[model samples]
Target: MAVRPPVSKSNVFLLMVTGEIESAEFPEYDGLYCNFSFFYGQDWTVLSNSSEGITQTSMRGSSPASNFVWNFPIDVTFKSTNPFGWPQIVVSVYGVNSLGRDEVRGYGSIHLPVTPGRHSLDIDMFVPEPASKLQKLVSWLIGPRPELVDPKFVARGEGREITRVSSQGFVRANVNIVMKDFSKQGYRNGTERFSNNSS
Candidate 1:
């Protein structure tokens, strides 16, 4: 048997970039990416490779182990671009099974507006664990101090903390939502704050 990661799991490959362009007028290329490990039967590490694009990146079952799902993710950053036309960004991923089979894929493409603004996407990095778990563990040992965004408020329950972030963001330390405990607390008097839905 061969060792492999499972599907139905998501690992954040890249930070949540505010914005990225599908294509640019000057074409500022970021780079290629990979999620699977390159080394096997030894201590694994941050495996990576440099390539022009996926058109040249290849995978084969003949290797000691094979990729079950060739699908990886790519993200783009928009430095500058023309004003007239929007360009399309294309991406694709495939996989092979033990029986030498390839998975059907969709020709992924994105048409980004030329106008400058913010954008975001869920990048995929095939680490063996969820991105959050990796962060908590590595950050502690590797001396990574999180940005520490101003938490509006903190409420803890059963080893879980609900933080109301400054940007009206609410993060549940636990991923479950349906069973989340909700409540209404009265302001002890003039401790009231007002907010509007208008951005």
Candidate 2:
């Protein structure tokens, strides 16, 4: 009889994400660009190099109510021993002003879908507002908009309550998620077991 090698158990699971930052609606803005990044827990390790990128500047369409189209691609893979900290994508948009400087227009974030399949997310974007009228006037004169020092702060709930922000616009994203060994790791949810077939 041939002896069988001992079976090895692996706890790691893979999360694959492929998507694009499709478009945005900034009614008053033109000549827009975007910056994107991921925020994940300590347990997660990125397996792909498409972690962060900047999109080319896009001008608003000629017609009224036309959105800025970037179609920026997103492809990333992550491996983790546990799902304690799922990943979230953070997006910051900027517009070229009369001074030709990039001024932050909006900030938004969305948690990656827990299930493995295609997902479309419309992230509501907001911009920090000046706390006082004097501050607002100064910013308007100086061409310095109220912007976050660290845009990733959008991903976290802490300390956000203290900041005053105004709704500016929204960004659309399309993402396809694939999971490996998720069920084998004893993590199963009603939605997690669904088929990958897009409806």
Candidate 3:
């Protein structure tokens, strides 16, 4: 009889994410819309190419009930050998101004939940402010607002310390996470660690 060889399994783990950008609360803004995109580390490979999307414009409702609803769907999968660089969703909110031009309202980002389950996130949003009084006056008069050259910068920590920003609003997200071969690689999910620490 010939001896059988043991098969080697791949170490790569898979993460599946499905969710929705439910709504937003921008108290000082109206006629709002949003743009969403993903940012991941080089170690991660997205199985699905649905990396970006734009939400339809929505106006805020009356006082005590001012929510801009998008209900935009988000579905993506990622494969990675390590968790050092988790995926993050970045959201940029904009509003139609009096001039009928889109002006950036806020920017926010949140890391995908590490546990394999449902997660609800409230992402606080902010907008860049003018550096000086002169710049503020010029922006108010010229019809352009201060905004990041690349909104993806919100997902990163570099060069953000010098940027001045003000709280604009918050976005709500509901995500369902599924993982395969995650624990087989001897990795502890976030929930597991949380429980362990609480004990």
Model 1 misplacement above 4 A: 1-52, 55-85, 121-199
Compare candidates 1 and 3 on lDDT and give the better one: 3
Candidate 1: give the clashing pairs.
19-119, 70-94, 70-95
**Using Cα atoms with residue i matched to residue i, what is each candidate's TM-score against the true structure?**
0.23, 0.92, 0.91
Better of 1 and 3 by TM-score: 3
Best by lDDT: 2
Q: Which 10 consecutive residues of model 1 have the lowest summed lDDT?
A: 171-180
Off by over 4 Å in 2: 1-5, 191-199
Clash list (residue pairs), candidate 2? none
Models sorted by TM-score, best on top = 2, 3, 1
lDDT of 1 by residue, 1-199 (tens): 9977766522211111122212211011112222211111122112233211443234333443333222333333221111122223333333333344442121222333222224432222111121476676874465332332211111112221332112111101101111000111211112123211110
Model 2 per-residue lDDT tens digits across residues 126-170: 999999999999999986888898999999889999999999999
Q: Name the best candidate (by TM-score).
A: 2
Task: Tell how far residue 30 is off in model 1, in angstroms.
Answer: 26
Model 2 Cα RMSD, 1 decimal: 2.7
lDDT rank order: 2, 3, 1
